[model samples]
Target chain A: MKTLFDKIWEKHVVESITNGPDVLYIDRQLIHEVTSPQAFAGLRKRGISVFRPQQVTATPDHNTPTLNQHLPIKEEASRKAVEALRENCAANNIMLFDLNTEYNGVVHIVGPELGLTQPGMTIVCGDSHTATHGAFGSIAFGIGTSEVEMALATQCLLQSKPKQMRITIDGNLGKGVTAKDVILYIIAQLTANGGTGYFVEYAGSAFRSMTMEERMTMCNMSIEMGARGGLIAPDETTFAYVKNRKFAPQGEEWSKKLLEWKLLFTDSNASFDKEYSFKAEDVKPFITYGTNPGMGIAIDGNIPVNEPNVKALEYMNFAAGEKLLGKPVDYVFIGSCTNGRIEDFRAAASIIKGRKKAENIFAYIVPGSKSVEKQAREEGLIEIFESAGFVFRQPGCSACLAMNEDKVPAGKYCVSTSNRNFEGRQGVGARTLLASPLTAAAAAVTGKITDPRELI
Target chain B: MQKLTILTSPCVPLNVESVDTDQIIPARFLKTTNREGFGKNLFRDWRYDSEDQPKSDFVLNSAKYSGQILVAGKNFGCGSSREHAAWAIADYGFRAVISPLFADIFKGNALNNGVLPIQVSENFVQTLFAEIEKNPKTEVTIDLPAQKITINSINLSEYFDINDYKKTCFINGYDDIDYLLSIKEKIEHYEVQKS
Candidate 1:
């Protein structure tokens, strides 16, 4: 009995050592500025080169300035990181997508949109959001910097395989529910550490019905819940999305790949170490009020009365049993590996269209990738955003980690579509309320946390 | 990597739950490549006031507490995958952190960076916190080879779990790269076979 995760993991196993971790071969590896420099340094210390430079792709995303991206990055530490990446990639013969390149964007977004992430491939990145690649039925996960060095030096990782978990969401999704809401609800129910020892497979009707971009959003936050990664079985919807992507296979190779991908689903008799079932009706447009993703509640619901909730509420200055429905929002940020796709933009832009951004709100509409930016412009999404007084900035992880100049001021509240709501995640003393793009859009227009369903 | 077979130190209790990596080392400090300087910015937001002055109420700044061990609330290191959190802790002179739960990536990062993340039971953690509250300078000993953490003042001892592979690395001060090099031939052989 082979589950989808089992099949993918087994096929990639290069050597299994007794009482030790499996030596798994990597099919593709993504490197970003923040994590790769130290790995390259370790390699130099050992007098070793990247084992398979062809399979490695380097990009500078985390440290790149969102605005004025064409000019030199101004922040001293941020500039050094980007420059080090440029120099290292050049010296190591690794392909790089630097700032201003059409291919330049967040590493997670650029990889799949360019077709580098494919089904049945074992993908790894130094960053945790690498799990986003699992939307295509691939076994993907994040690694530490030392593991990045290991992957570069050997094209293999000594990894202890994680146990399997199957999370099945059945029934139809209610109105205003998005892939983001479903995940937030799961994390809330499961808690941040719920999936710590498992690799989750999102299955059944709800996940099957999600668009590729939606699936990507769902998998992107898997790390937030402490899961090594999450994956979905690739079907026709996945194939269609991968068909003409820039790096996707062409001609006869496409047909051959499609046939193999179609067989990637879990067998009926396959057993998982643990299983969970949830109803799509139970999921609603959600928002996190506290410091962690797990401290989320429904749009109209009260915060849970618990010890963690008490601490989180104290930090957030929110009272338990007090409704979060009308809390004012100061900033609205829409971008990250979590919800920066074309679909996310469409959802936000549709809500913002024909209405101006609230005067009290500073809304930033950032696309995930340069490709996404181009598509948004061609589709006039950018025009709608700009006309509504929202700033449509160039693609980088702006205001997500606040690595650049676009930081929310201290003590301000931001309705962000990013993955994490950790304390001071947006900036020092800045509070983040993680929400779907639609929810953020709703807040942007109303200057408060209004349910997107009310606006829709 | 530092050999961590046995460590004895006082504990600084941070009772707040789910202390994430962002709280440990803020993202603004993650831009630099050098790992050593991170200690100064460890818990940058919490340790300092808006004016960049050290807050007297913060545990690290208090005269009553001084230790190489941090006894924290559950779910320590739960956010980003930045190893700088571990670097900050190690650089700040903490040899070990005892918690009821730890996020997986952060635990791995801590281990690789020579900061021991010792997972004890919730009751044990609460007891440690209470004991630390009673006496901030109470000493605790962690024996890595025996997988035991002993709170000397409380006369309590608990065993922790670590994989043999990691345990070997921890005791010998070997990093992942060191192990990879030791098994370089095996990696090369498998790569050739796969190709």
Candidate 2:
């Protein structure tokens, strides 16, 4: 009768207070530059050290400069944060993926790429997108800095267990609809607050058919709908993806681990607190038209007629019932923790192989990690991008939150493949339209909001 | 964390729905390791113009309304797990935020800090906004032990819920990690058993 989330959570729960949060042990802890400095300072103030330093992994991502990675970072605050991460990791003897290292990338992407994110593990990070690791059937979510310190000290956290939600998407996905579009469609249909108190498990055929990278992208944005995290049951697809990675178990140990992971699925008799089913056909090449991620519509669909829609239209400089067929866009960013994988680039490149980017659009193609960048270049994807007139930037969380120099200008429209479309997220007064890489590629070549299906 | 037993202040009403953390504290301001100095940057884009001048039309800049409690619309603090959002709110002199709903991470962050996030019924939230709109000086008191929020003008009272452990922390002005450390023996024992 227990759901997969419950089974995982129950296994991790060390001690449960009668009516309070359960103290759940963490297996893998991920750290990054932005939210970890205060935590380390707190440990120092208390004259304490990290409990299990080997369990922790740190990287410099949020504030790292995307361009000229080897050069001295220019911004004082950005440079300080990156420096602080290096100093802290070195002082503590913790594993750090320095900017020069091949392992360095967004913390979320680097975790799975290195095989550090195993199925049935409890992972925590200070970044909300930690849910991306939940794609491996792990109970993973974001934590505050204090919780970061607690996890650093105890390798555990006190968390109130969330209710279970099973969102089943069946049927076949239409052409040009990527995992990014599927998630955007779900968030929009569910609204921003729909999954407020649930740990969602994506089930059914559509999710099962997705590649590991696609599943990661789908789970990455679960937090946008207010879900604590999201997960998919482990299967052959999951096992096959985890094989032969850097930190994954080798040979005999792999078979033993796979045997255990095989039982990670939800039993047919298991029940969830809530369940929602959707037809994959209902999803299209989606794009957000407002300040929030939930304010999304299909690429060829009309904006909904509502007071909130009117307000969103006002903010986005769009009109109610207006079709966003050829809405002018100033920028197109194809990277973030959300869609900065090699598969994302392949999807975008497949659409823009021979077409030059629209003369008016400033487009960027950034890989999620150094290895992803290397793999893309090795496969000639960078040449495809350059030939299509797109600037291929170094890997980091560039233009996602505009913490670096890749900010979208004020009052400009950017069709981004990032998770969020919040007001001023890319820059002050910068309007973001969330979409898939294919849709972004189409918009980049057309200089306006165009559906990838039309070009496909 | 400071003791938050009781607080009475004129309500600052922000009626906009789904106010995300990015709008609460922009990412550019998140560079500092210290939680200090975020107050000035709270709602940085909304509160300031391109020239860094205070926007006269922004709610925080209005002199008529001043309070430590902000009565916001539904789904407040809806995106990002940046505790900087809570830091900015607390530093901006807000002692509490009352809304119909709050993002789970934001609620956790608020409670960990000294800020009390009160989840009231939608009707009560609407009433608070209406009362605040009708009279800018509408004062509301949150009694933590009693778990009641009273509107002075309307003579109305509503109760809210908070976890007992969190409530204990709020009333005693205790650090959260210290509480977890109090049960360190039990945690270690369990870890040993599992291994």
Candidate 3:
């Protein structure tokens, strides 16, 4: 059966030669500081110019220091990487959003905000979180350094189609349940590997009720579940979000474009290779108990006591039948592509306002981008966070996967809003419990695991 | 330079579904800037014990099979977008990765590195896994020219779609810049025409 993913994939598949790979036309290519150096080196080695400079955009985020953007980069290797991107962009005639620039921020955040991401476009970036753009109804995903080079030199790619899976969330979401909770709940249901071999299309009443930003948040985490990418059909919410954006078609052109995008949904009887449907009310705030994102359970649920997964139990150092409630946390980190946006800050602040942090807990609130930070300050969210003993850090991918100095020490437990709670993801021997920003803030206030619904 | 042709040996069969990039090369190993020597650490956490020792329980450590081509279950190279994951897999001498599905980014990275990633039907993948389990040393042939993979006596063919430019580069062992340089004359002509 031809699913929507298959339909889109086949339409973009240029040609498939016998015993060879398919030729795919790339619509958009995004680059960042961390991975673009080698790609530029590859380009210089061959002395070739960029094939389609206008279609590609580069930014410095992964290695950009969040503490003080004005100061030069403290790490030499990171400095060189950022400099190399600047030089490469200059030489290749590519557009670059340098640090401190108005357009500069996390590649994922900047891409969507700039209206560069549109429905039905195929977007690729050097960062895996590129899937964040899939909220715009595009087939967005990450690529490697070499592939980044390939796209820079030639705006095209070689790709095989993925199987399609439909995750239909029926019914209405319970009160105080945000899109973050919905995705966390879905992750708990599917496990981390449940979506393997598929491009997931999130459907049903619950998805249709979500705002465009909430939909983006849901699609952003699709990669965490091993899906190639996640998409939602373009609807009025999507149209309204892109209407006033910078890159969206304006005036009469926008009306025409919206008409075309309106037809992007799955047919009434569209078939998928696999399907799973659940009621939204069944979902709850979830957290991970093991190293992988798949090892998730409801906030109030007890840890699984099964012996067959003994290795996981040992690594997590968790006993069977133990309730996760009141579990002491050493730290709380709220940031990353997953939950580093303005709404995420508001959610966390709402919980922490007029509250004091637990004596033993250290919390860090890092925004996704400079713009996010600006918005937070304008909303006075930072005051609420600081008053509650949360450290307000600058914008960057801070402590998400611990690429920089911000990391949880060995043997400590942290409740984080970042994606991926895999063993040692934040640091060697560090335990991460993935949660929503609200849940993380709730943990910070109580110094223990607690549901955000209580604060709401 | 001649085109890089990937010849598959059937001994190595990967049957796990959704083999994410984290499993290929974990986030902890991504701290280093070096790219040349990651093959040993490929799937280190999964293939080894907590004491940094090899786990006898892992499939890679089994003595029955060792080959260049990896035949995996579905959704290979999922999770975070670390190019090092693809590099580690390719450096580990796995020239071709056959699976029912692949993460979008990992697929691009794999192909760019000259590692052929083939996607087949679920039934075909299951049959291949079953055959490998029955005979650990069962051989499969991947003919790049024919774009077909043969297991046992049955021959099944699948096509991998790539861009025309990338196709030339892969066939000629030309990286991104090399492909572009080869067309320097054409680019110059275009620039002159625009001027």
TM-score, per-candidate, Cα-based: 0.97, 0.98, 0.83
Candidate 2 lDDT over A346-372, as tens digits, reads: 988998898999999998778899999
Tens digits of lDDT, candidate 1, A1-456:
899999988877877767667878889999999988888988888799988899999888887877878888888889999999999899989999889898999999999999999999999998888889999999999888878888999888888889889999999988888999999999998998888878999999998899999999999999888898999999889988898998899999899888888889899999999899999998999999888898898999987665456757776888777788998989999999899999999999889999999989997778889999999999999999989988898898888888888788888999999999887888888889999999999999999999999888
Estimate the TM-score for candidate 2. Answer: 0.98
lDDT of 3 by residue, A74-165 (tens): 87777777788899889888899898877777788888877888887789987777778878778887778777777777666655566788
**Runs in model 3 with CA error above 4 Å?**
A1-13, A16-22, B1-20, B26-37, B40-76, B92-108, B114-195
**Model 2, A153: alpha-carbon shift in Å?**
1.5
Q: Which residue pairs show backbone clashes in model 1?
A: none
TM-score, model 1 to reference: 0.97
Deviation in Å, model 3, residue B180 alpha carbon:
10
Supply every candidate's count of residue pairs whose N, Cα or C atoms clash at under 3 angstroms: 0, 0, 14
